[model samples]
Target chain A: MAEVVTNLSRKEQVIRMAAELFKEKGYSAASMRDLAQKLGIEAASLYSHIKSKEEILRTLCFDMAAEFRTSLSEVEKQNVSASEKLRLGIIGHVKVMAKDLTASAVFMNEHRHLSQPWLRDFLLLRINYINRFKTIIEQGVSTGDFKKDIDTKLAVMTLFSSLNWMPGWFNPDSTIEPEKLGQQLADMLINGLKQNA
Target chain B: MAEVVTNLSRKEQVIRMAAELFKEKGYSAASMRDLAQKLGIEAASLYSHIKSKEEILRTLCFDMAAEFRTSLSEVEKQNVSASEKLRLGIIGHVKVMAKDLTASAVFMNEHRHLSQPWLRDFLLLRINYINRFKTIIEQGVSTGDFKKDIDTKLAVMTLFSSLNWMPGWFNPDSTIEPEKLGQQLADMLINGLKQNA
Candidate 1:
């Protein structure tokens, strides 16, 4: 049983290593053999943990998408206004990216690399997460919390696009603390960039 | 002479085809033979225009980087306030991405795959562009255009993060015009998502 558990963790490790390689090198370029070598195991030994390279890609993409959804869901439970929800979502997003940069990169950059059925499923999940933000914006507008002229579609796109790409440049050791980082992003999202009266 | 001209065009076509393939299939898996087949030419015929697959990648990545730099520089040339320059720079960026989605995608997503010298040059260009935004934010603070307490680093990061990922979702035909998109984005960057008094 212990061996089985260790084997499972080793499989998880392989998936993670492969996820980084896939995000960096892309799907068609990453190979089982390269992944096996990275893990210090024979290429054939990888079969014990995962069936194929596609499986690894699917796992990484799915897990990242799921994590994003869960994070947003958790944020929703807080007693915040619609605008604050948007802010919390951005904060949650950046935190997740900071915590797991590689996985976030894979989720953002390589979801299309998955095969047909998997791609559809992954996209479905992503679209759902996107809609959560959209609905929040709609609610804000309806309640007079957000500007009526606010293009919810474009606003959501702009907001999420800003938050989604944070992993590419966010360094934890930088001068900004994570808490402050979230606050500024919230400020940017809630208020306009221009100085208020 | 006419045949030679046709041959040159064909060779150029091969390079373009290879770039698309590289972006789609990646560098390693996108074999020269695959490129030749896509171009409906013999693999040997490809050498007249490009020396190797790596050379093609170099050209593609460099040209893409150059386009992004040129866009930013154009904004820099305009005699405007730092805030306005930042807005115009972002507009130029979105327009470039709109014009050349493939090149922009490859440039942003595939730079890490580049060899050392090429990679270094590309990173330098990227840093230059990033600094352009940072300088604008710094100026905004110095001139009292923006709040001094604003974390310029985070401000710049949020600004660019929103702009960098525009191409990923921007649709030229989806209602919002380029100028309007620029204004909205600028509003978000300068003012943020907060409601006004």
Candidate 2:
């Protein structure tokens, strides 16, 4: 039983290693053999854990999706205002990226590598996730908290685009704390870049 | 001489085809042979126009960089206020991305594929371009146009993060004109998202 549990964790280790490889070498270019090599195991041995390169890509993308949806669900349950929800959403999203940079990068950039059925489903999940933000912005507008004239679609795009791109340049070693960075982003998005009009 | 001119145009065509391929297949995964096949030419014939795959990537990235810097310079020359400059900057940036979606995607996503001195130079150019926005935001803060308490670095990150990610989701066929979309984004970024706050 202990050996079985260790094997299961080793399987997870394979996925984690694949995520880093995918992040560094990109999904299409990084072969399963390369992943196996990275793990100091024979190429055939990798099969015991993961099915194929596509499986790894699918796992990374969906796992990250699950992470975001989980966070969004938590935020949705809060009895906070739309503005506060937006703030928490940003923090949740950014923290996920900050904590798992490799998974986030792969999730954002390699979703297209997923094959059909999975690709279609993943894209749907992505759109639904984005719509969550859109719905929040709509709620804010309806409540007179957000500008009614603002394009809600464009606002959501701006917010998600900014949040999604964070993993690309965000450095864990940087002086800026991830939580603080999230707050600043929330402030800018919620308060606008302008001061006193 | 006519043949020579034709050859020159074919070289340009090779670069253009490579841009499309890089956008579709990604930089590292795309082979020169794939580009040649896409162009309906022999792989060896491709050598007459481009030296290597990296050369094509270099051309695309630097070319896009040049396009942006040119636009940024024009925006910089304007005697408008910092806020106006920022609005125009957003418009210019979005327009460029909209006009050349393939090249913009390559530039934004494939720059990491560039190697050596070229990579170093390209990153420097990118930083300088980002600093232009940082300077404008700083000027806004100094002039009390933007929130004084805002972190300038974070502000620049949020702005460029939003702008650079535009190519990923922007659909030229969409109802929103690129200029109008830019205006909406500028309005959101320049004015707070909250209404009547």
Candidate 3:
């Protein structure tokens, strides 16, 4: 058990370093040697831990997807109102992006570099993830919590677009904390910026 | 006059082809030779019309920026309610993206590839563009057309995020006409997606 924990931590370290490099140089331009130089490790040693750069990218994309899926699943199981569920889901998505800015950047930007069957699979996973939001919005409309006229697909797209673009602009040192920002976004999306009578 | 017209038409043809190539192969991997080959002209002849590959990128970015600025200027002159101004601003934005899908895609994706002083200028222009939205939303809040409790900056960011992302997913062939889709987005943003009593 101890040995396995140690090995996993070492792999995690490699992933961390790789994410920064990938984010800075882009996945296509970044090389294993560059990653090793950044890590102060021999290139061969880097290879021993991770099979290839593609593996690292695949891991990052799938891991981020898995984290989202797990979070959404938990949100799904909660016996909360549809609006609450949507809010929690948005918060969960923002928190994930906030937790690892570099990894999230790579996950969002480098998915285009993913090859073959994995590319197709990753896309389907993304669709499924988006559908979760759509389902929540649909439920809200059905329950009369959300505006019935709302285009569910467009609403989901808007929500995801707003949430996904965070890594591009979010500053970790900003005065607005991530959780608070998440709540603010949820409030705006649900209640809008216009005050009602 | 005829000769000048022909020359300008040829230049427009090159820009159009360049936009397509830039969108497909990306700014970095795309080359002058490839662009020339696509146009069935000698690479040197391509130089007679355009200075360099960077010139193409610069032209596309700045041209798109100019279009947005022009549209916003028109929107700014309208004597409408603050909410109406924002709606018009968004519609103008979507219309630009819808009209030139390829150029807009290149403008969004390849802005990072812009070199040196132009890159810095482009970044400033983007900030200026975003500030325009911020200003409109602020006006809405000041006039009580928007909720005072809303965070102006986040609201602007959310609006841009939603509008800017249209290029990534918008299918020109979709049955949803761009004008109607723009109206729908405006409605959602101005009035929260929640059902009101």
**Could you give me the TM-score of model 1 versus the true structure?**
0.88
lDDT of 3 by residue, B1-197 (tens): 99999998998899899999888767665778888899999888987787887888899999999999898989999999888898999898888889898999899877887778999999999999899888888887788787778788888888888888888888889998888889989988878522341
DockQ of each model vs. true complex: 0.58, 0.51, 0.46
Could you give candidate 2's per-residue lDDT for residues B1-197 as a string of tens digits? 99999987988889988999998878877887898899998889988777888888898899899999999899999998888899999999988888898899999898987889998999999999999889998888787777667777777888888898888778878988889888888888877522333
Q: Enumerate residue pairs that collide in model 2.
A: none
RMSD of 1: 3.0
- DockQ, model 3, C-alpha based: 0.46
Task: Give per-residue CA lDDT, model 1, range A55-98, as digits (tens).
Answer: 88788888878778899999889888887888888778777777
Candidate 1: list runs displaced more than 4 Å: A173-177, A193-197, B1-8, B27-29, B172-176, B193-197
TM-score of each: 0.88, 0.91, 0.89
Computed on alpha carbons, the lDDT of every model, listed in order, comes to 0.77, 0.86, 0.85
lDDT of 1 at A84: 80
- Residue B164, model 3: lDDT of 81
- Distance from true location, Cα of A13 in model 1, Å: 2.4
- RMSD per candidate (Å) reads 3.0, 2.7, 3.1
For residues B1-197, write the lDDT of model 1, one tens digit per residue: 99999987876787678767766765666788898899888889888788877777777778877887888878888888877777788778777776766666666666677888888988898888888889988887787777767777777777777776775677646876777787777766666522232
